[model samples]
Target chain A: MPMTTTPAEPVTPAGPTVPGEPAAVAEPRRRRRAAAGWVLLPAVAVLLVFFFYPLATIVWSSFTEPTVGLANYTALFTDGVSVTVLLRTLRTALIVALVALVVAYPYAYAMTRVSRRTRAVLTVLVLLPFWTSVMARNFAWYLLEQRDGLIDRFFSLFGIDGVVLLGSVTGVTVAMVQVMLPFMVLPLYSNLSSIDLRLMDAATSLGASRPKAFARVYLPLSLPGVVSGFSLVFIVTLGFFVTPALLGTPQQSLVSQVIETRVGDLLDFPGAGAMGSVLLAVTLVVLFAVSRIAKPTAALNQAVDRA
Target chain B: MPSTRAGRPRSIGWGLRLWVTAVAVLLLAPTLVVIPMSFGAGQTFAFPPKEWSLRWYEEFFSSPQWMSSVVTSAQAALLTGVLATVIGVAAAIGLDRGRFPGRELLRSAMMAPMIVPGIVVAVAIYGTFLRWHLNGTLLGFVLAHTVLAVPFVITSVSTSLAGYDSTVEVAAASLGASGWTVLRRITLPLLMPGIASGFVFAFVTSLDEVVIALFLQTPEIRTLPVQMYDSITLEIDPTIAAASSLIVVVTTVALLLPQLVRRRRSES
Candidate 1:
């Protein structure tokens, strides 16, 4: 196996004695290599037993339950409520990604232009919300969107009266955009900062207008960041549970809500498992597609590294 | 137009800064709003409170149900921190020091939990835990949360290990120090900051986690987030605002503490 070969080749010459001593030294080095591999066992075992095992069980049940053979999958496709929720979930994710991108772009751009002290403050503003509990942030939104609450009262002052945001798609979208904005900003900022400002200077020196220089020289360069940020926000919004559940009503229910309902209220385990499987599959597919276009992991690591 | 070229971008920069400031305000609004709301004397959540008091905070402290959930969350988070850091540090060392085929794959698999949607993992665990009868147990909560928390620990520890010079271990070994001795005396002490930060990250992750906790919660066992969720969805009590504010303060402090320490260390 490649596993045995890769470590053995390097360790052979580095064995306990001179390079000429082959058989005796090779044995202990091999044993050490094997022992090093065994260090991975606890983590691997934990993941297998607790993480992958449960996930596999869910996939298994989705196939086998209710006298199996694709029944659940078929039902998921044919069921009107399920299909609508699935589509709505996708649409919501797309909207949240786009909205967050639009809102985050100028801020992330401005971050690149700011002094180091100002940029540090801006980064904290971005990350504070990111680190706060999802439930806390959602609860704050829930209160704000309620009738005669902060949002409604603020709107009423402008003569925009009787507009209820709670339980509406607007409220859910606003909350999600707020929650996902940091995800968009961090990656975009990392990518933007890495770009050499000299490129813009060069374009300007070539007699390109500032806007033209930005569009032609800068935007395309930051495309990888945009792609990475969009996919990150979209995938996270796809499975968003807390904000929507707290703020949205049945009319605006997303797929996670449906999964929660199926499992939590209805006690339909296999059905929920099928929905989860679909969500997981779609998430992985989107990640795979995004990876083809941009290195999401590199963007993520850069952002985290900056933080 | 020479002056225009120089002045135009500065003008745009000012406008962008204004826009960015507005966005920052919008981002901070929820956290800032909740703190004042937590002090509202009214029974229900209302803005610009006519009365301000600490009744809700007192309520949160006095209520056994709320207090118990706090205890439960702390216990689970603490256990998860210890368990995840130990396992994650071992995995990181193995991956960093040991070169073999499938090492990349193993590392990716370790990180899969972070990418997979939380609800899917929650549902999967909920289903399997139902069979294992681990649904409401503390061990169940720790194990499931550790699965989620380990990835962060690994990421943090791995970053630290990347800067670490492994030849130090080779030198120690050559000087007659054993493997365990080298790890104990040399490697771990050098990696202490990363491991500590990883522990805090794991703790915060488990503390903030709600999806798996939601699935695992029973009447007898509920974490703070799950309880807060129930309060928001099922009741209109403003005590949750108090609870939420507390979490915001505590988590911000916890998250920033390591950075502060690191900065001070660098300065020194």
Candidate 2:
């Protein structure tokens, strides 16, 4: 609006009032776009080579590395322990996602009610552990859960023993939930902040209790966050190797450790590749299922359409 | 929330205050332990540490081995920070400022590296590099970490650019400026905070990374985390405490730059 109008006219040039001049004017725009493509082609090429190729390479390696033809993937299903671990991994992922929501939603809601400075500080604290090395976090948890660790001392002070939270599946699950809580929290906080407080007030004025107001007015409104958080934590939790490796006993091994053992300890490249392929297959199927649930673009449309 | 206003949680509720204080202290438990451990007078990794001394800190400064790993990690982090930030800033601008095909796909791909398990990527890259004979080298670590760190740069810089208006660039261009000139003169200043945030994030990620360092580590070139891993897993010692404290200090500074900016922004 504030522009000197002459410059705008030259770019768009009430063009083609003179037909030959239209092509002259359009030519540079086309070339500029074409030039952009040329500039972008190298980046796209890098992605294809680095990102796309490795994904395909692992898939192919699974099949062809050892005497060819589905041996690796087939071996995973055929091996009972592998199948069990995959199932356990999925189970753990779901539980983590569930626990993250349970823990994060209340905190996020509380965050929204707090003053900006308080929220900022809290958000920083929530993000603090994340900023540190995951290894460091895991080690800290290890220390806390150890026999002589702080938590153990506290429990022992209360005269409790035989408490094995660190090396158990439960310990790993709790750690995983802690690890993924921020993923669940941030999206919810975004959606929650966007909500006008009046909706809850309106619900309350109409005789709804706090829980009722949250359920009827807030929950449906925040479905996008729930979906996003669930998918994110679930997908990430599916790929986790570190927490399990650090916290879980041998029996609690995840698919990642299996693959690592195969490749690193076993030197069975084909088997490792095959296991990777199987995990990839499951991930794709699970991802598709999640995308269906997330309906991300559709959710945006729904939000837009709501307005 | 306001129902509890007069006699409850926010006002005269000492119980609530106590709970909040307790929770905050509980949250800080792990971080606080680092200090006591750092000051351990004993050679063991014990809490309450038997006594209090700065011997480990002295050892950290005196030991060339620990210092070299710190130097290597810093170099790698700096290189990764710059590389990731440049590529990330370019990609962020390209995505936000330019309309292009497959933009969403390109973005998802760019951000995907961060989501991929560090071990998986490390192992995959190790496998790839083995065939190309790219292992056991600093360049390999740099390239691998640059890839790992790019997603953070992209996410942060993208969010920063979200607050940006592209019409300014268009206006600049229409005012007879070239694209590069418009970007240099109009865009860079606004994006500086975001780029710096991304830079810090990249540095932190590079510094803290261990899984990738593990598979890529050779005697010739290894980072702090790798050394920590080797030290702890092989021979437990007090030196590790000093190293951890030092990284924590550096990391706290790096991580807080964006926070300071945020606080300043909020204050203004």
Candidate 3:
């Protein structure tokens, strides 16, 4: 009788109870909701201790070491070697990014034109290198580009003998472009695939030549991918260590190499910290500048969505 | 859309197709060359490697030093995968379900590792870990690699979480299910794919990571990639080709396993 009474009573009462619950339940639920955010504490804590704190230490050491007041910062400008290396890094990254873009655009376009089966094959080709280890790929390049390696031997058949590739900027750039083409192609392919084919047909029917139609219709829509891909390639190349380190000589050392030498060889913590901070600053500035110009946030989201 | 007009511009299309094929070959050539080169009969890296031999593979498999580095790398990668996934999944769930101030800022902060250059991170970690006396320690390797690997996990888990419906959790709650039960029965099952992928990704990232390992490496401890780096830069040995091919095979298999699992699940 008690169980039956409880069940029967609640059936009628529950309908009215729901309407009356908000006043009592709202405050406590809101408080509970806020407390749930603390679940992020462990991750935030780990990163703070390991990531942000270390970075802060580097930034702090840059000023405080060997007497304070911007000496390291000033030395970045005054020291010819540091400045030259920084400039060279920027120059080389730009060259690599542009060259990769040139190679990737056509490949990505071809991917869009192909059938699904063919596209899958092309994608695997692009991804094979990406999935391979950087050390392995760079080593392959090292063997091929060495003085009497495959590339040079092949060049000899064309009467272009004794060409120097290894230990040169050309060798480093070639390897980098190969390594980075996937980064360029994937973004460009996603952007291109999303494009409507009719727009090209529409532009061509409106009396624009094929190239003209592509420039006016396709190129503008594809600009977002281009900007995102180029910046991604450039930023990654800026901090590249493996390819440049193996293929390049001291004369062509990038800023990352500079940082490594300062810390490892010279034991110049503050000097290396200064260089690291500068590189970080430049990367952030470039990232923000690109995001501002091209809505890279949207492009990045699209890329991630497709992935 | 214009298949009927395809023959109008045949020459240019032919040329473009050829160029794209060439680019694909260029991308594949470097990685493929290692397969043949790894079998070089000569001591040095040589083109067309005069004769085929498995001596380098024997060297890789037989050398205690090389085998130990492989073991060390695998141990670190396994630890990194577990640590990063636990931390990353919690952060992703918190971001998804919690409504609080600075939530966007926290999300970006979690992702910052991916954007920050690797060498910059390596230098920062090296400098800090040196002072903390963490350099070259196994704990140091796991912690530092976790910092790099966590972002990938967060990205993967967040993507999966974005598609999850919260109304089912609310329904389970109203039926008197405990919070943990709802998470275990409803949420975790849906998120299993993401978690698995995240684990694999973190593992591969640690295995592939060289810059940080290079800085943090002690003479007592070294990862396979660091060993390969030394072998290539400090000495040009054919044994490195064997190591590289092994890495390529292992990583490709690791990356493909998740997709295969998903395909099987969908089919069933």
Which candidate leads in TM-score?
1
lDDT of each: 0.83, 0.66, 0.80
In order, the candidates keep a fraction of the true contacts of 0.53, 0.07, 0.53
Q: List DockQ, one per candidate, in order.
A: 0.50, 0.27, 0.46
In the range A152-264, model 3's lDDT, one tens digit per residue, is 99899999998758998888988999998887887788788888777877877777777788888899988878988888888889888888888988887888888888888
TM-score of chain A of 3: 0.86
TM-score of 2: 0.85
Pick out the ten consecutive residues of candidate 1 chain B with the lowest summed lDDT.
B1-10
Pairs in steric clash, model 2: none
Model 1 residue A176 lDDT? 93
In the range A180-240, model 2's lDDT, one tens digit per residue, is 6666766666667677777777777777776788789889887766787777677778777
- Winner on DockQ (1 vs 2): 1
Regions of candidate 2 where Cα sits further than 4 Å from its true position: A1-32, A39-42, A292-307, B1-27, B97-100, B253-268
Clashing pairs in 3: none
Q: Per-residue lDDT of B1-268 in model 2, one digit per residue for the tens?
A: 4542321212324544454444444444565566567788987766667798999999888888778888888888888888777767766656653456677877777766755544456567767766766676777767778777776776676777778885576566666776456557887887887787778778877888887777777877788888776666567766777776765666566557767996799889
